[model samples]
Target: MTTTRPIQSGRRYRRIIYALIGVGIASLLGGMFLDYSLAGLVVYAVTAVGALALTLFLQFGSEIELQDEREREIGRRASDVTFQLFGYLGLVVFVAMFLLEATSQYTMTARAETLLYAYAVICLTWGGIYVVFRYRS
Candidate 1:
């Protein structure tokens, strides 16, 4: 009798991501403790770009499919959950900022406004797409 083992591509990809995360964290700490802030930022930027490229490659460039049906479904569901969670989190932050500004006479920072605007745009885009798809279907 012959037996076959399942493909471990997903496991391999996950391991790579974890390793990159570890290295990124180590680089960040080393940069901070060594008083090389610029080096740390450079390291982080490089790591971010590398990670994005690696993820795109793993997700779309692989010759073999790594995710099974169940894995894909789970990923979809997890994405939805995070999307909703982050939307709510952004709203909460916006509201908190308003309250703080009103009570403490604090002005919103440019960074905070930029973040809020980005969050709002993303949420609106998501909502618009969802509505269009739901109505069309």
Candidate 2:
């Protein structure tokens, strides 16, 4: 006698996510390159649909056991490391730009200045969350 195991819900969810991403990218490319009048609307609709799917998945993923605790912990650590790396890299770029501007006739563009300010805000928010979590623990 042979026993068959059912497919995992996590695998099904990942496949759905991949399909959504593929459709979204295709729609975006078509919108950019095609001459259709409704191309922009199609792209927007695809993006909205993808976002809704993701929101739903996030809301119910834990309850469904979409990821095991080990997987979830790994994801959390990976995201934390990614954010820390981005913060440090942004700080380096900001300092380099400032130094270049101060030592030469180079002036930072408005967009770059805005990005620096945005980075500052993100870092401050992260710090606040860290403090809250620290005290709560």
Candidate 3:
């Protein structure tokens, strides 16, 4: 008799979904604060759809419908590549900005710095999660 293994990494998918939902919410809020009512509504709608999808997946998804080993492997590889690319891009942007600031009289704006900080935080969090799982396993 042969037994099949269930997709055990459902939690990972859940985390990703939740993260996306969080981003959508943040975008919505930022739009509202900036008086972009239409954009905010659009963001809210998209976030609602994402939440609905998460709910449906949690309630009705089967093991095979979740993610198999091969799918998980592909996701990991994609994530690693994306993270590396983002890191390189961020480093280039940072160095360019640093040189520009040093050589010119212009300074970084508060809004730009805030966005950069947020991106840095997101990257750090994503990388930290990857490291935790890679070493834990």
Candidate 4:
């Protein structure tokens, strides 16, 4: 008789969490494209709540050690790069939109205005966080 090793509980839990996240994303995307019925709204709300609960459980409830120090360092570097890249890209796009409106008859759309406001907020938040961190460190 062939013997099989049982799966570790931590690994099994991680797989379940990944599957749930995938299903949640798929349902959210499906809900976005389809009609906005009451049932659809309920499904979306449930999915969102489930996802949030899973995230919180992963953060505080579970005893599973997910990432090592190296992994966390890599994640921090990636996050820093992503934040800078998006901030610069948003600034460039906002400036281009503003210049186009200034030079030509093209008027900024509501979406463009929204982007401008979002970029401003992002910059301000980043600056404030930087100041706090700089002073704290």
Candidate 5:
């Protein structure tokens, strides 16, 4: 397909980027809100819904022509970066929490929800950049 510039990316890629960011924020905030002061599997459910919404947007609203090779590659790299950061920090935090829980004889204050929020934030940040670059490309 013909793109505006001599590049394999287009504006639709940006649409996807923004949508993914919305998903990340929804996941992080929903997770935290339901955990810090609220409790239940509601946070998880909301995260799932957020993903679903993104799927719906991509399927219905996002034009398919924009996701060319360059945009896809960019998105892939973004996701990988986000995943690595999330994984490393998540592991460290969990490990530290466990150690503290053991040594201090007190349960860790931060729960699974906290972990999920932090992870979601990373996803949101990466997704935001993906969207921005998608448009700029």
Candidate 6:
């Protein structure tokens, strides 16, 4: 590869960062798949944030481990892709929630908390990724 690739990470920290990403994704998936309850969704969102924090800490901890130009571009493109995805996902959920409320005969109340938290996760994820990408860029 070009000089753009970052130095290969040591196994320990590399494993830690990889695990953090996996756990973060798992948390998000679990939140969506679990019962349609506010509390469970909140707990899962918290877990995702914790995983995100850990990833940031390990990734930038090494001065010499900084990503090069190609890596920076990769990170940016990745975040932009993720942001578009979550943005659409959140908007669809919100629209569906409102539409269901408007026309449904059942007096079903939408869980505002769940909707808010879902959007919050999208916001935070996009923001976090944007920051990392921008900094590296």
Clashes of each: 0, 0, 0, 0, 1, 0
Check candidate 2 and list the clashing pairs.
none
lDDT score at residue 24, model 4, on the 0-100 scale? 63
Candidate 3, 1-137: lDDT as tens digits: 96544554565666667877887888888888999968977987887798778768765875534566687899989988997898889879877887889989558889879968987898889879889999999
Candidates ranked by TM-score? 2, 4, 1, 3, 6, 5
What shift in Å separates residue 125 of candidate 3 from its native position after superposition? 1.2
What are the clashing pairs of model 4? Answer: none
* Each prediction's TM-score versus the true structure: 0.64, 0.73, 0.54, 0.72, 0.42, 0.45
> Compared with the true structure, what per-residue lDDT tens digits does model 6 show for residues 1-137?
55533455534445665676666566556656775456555655665677567656756664445455787899989978997887888788767766776788334445775666778886887689879999998
**lDDT winner among the candidates?**
1
Task: State the weakest 10-residue window (summed lDDT) of model 4.
Answer: 3-12
Tens-place lDDT per residue, model 1, 17-101, is 6677677778888999999877887887777677777878877887545577888899999999999898888889899899999
The better-scoring model by TM-score among 4 and 5 is: 4
Off by over 4 Å in 4: 1-14, 32-41
Residues 20-92, candidate 4: write the lDDT tens digits. Answer: 6677666666766775455555665676677677757865886664555676899899989999999889878
Clashes of 4: 0
Question: What residue runs in model 3 are displaced by over 4 Å at the alpha carbon?
Answer: 1-64
**After superposition, which runs of candidate 5 have C-alpha atoms over 4 Å from their true positions?**
1-63, 110-137
Better of 3 and 4 by TM-score: 4
lDDT assessment of candidate 6: 0.66
lDDT of each: 0.81, 0.77, 0.78, 0.74, 0.65, 0.66
TM-score of candidate 1 to 2 decimals: 0.64
On TM-score, who's better, 1 or 5? Answer: 1
User: Candidate 5's residue-wise lDDT over 1-137, tens digit each?
Assistant: 84455222336455555666666566567667766423324544555576667557755885545466876899989978988886788768777767877798657555665866777687688779889999999
lDDT, candidate 5, at 82: 82
| Poorest lDDT segment (10 consecutive residues) of candidate 2 | 3-12
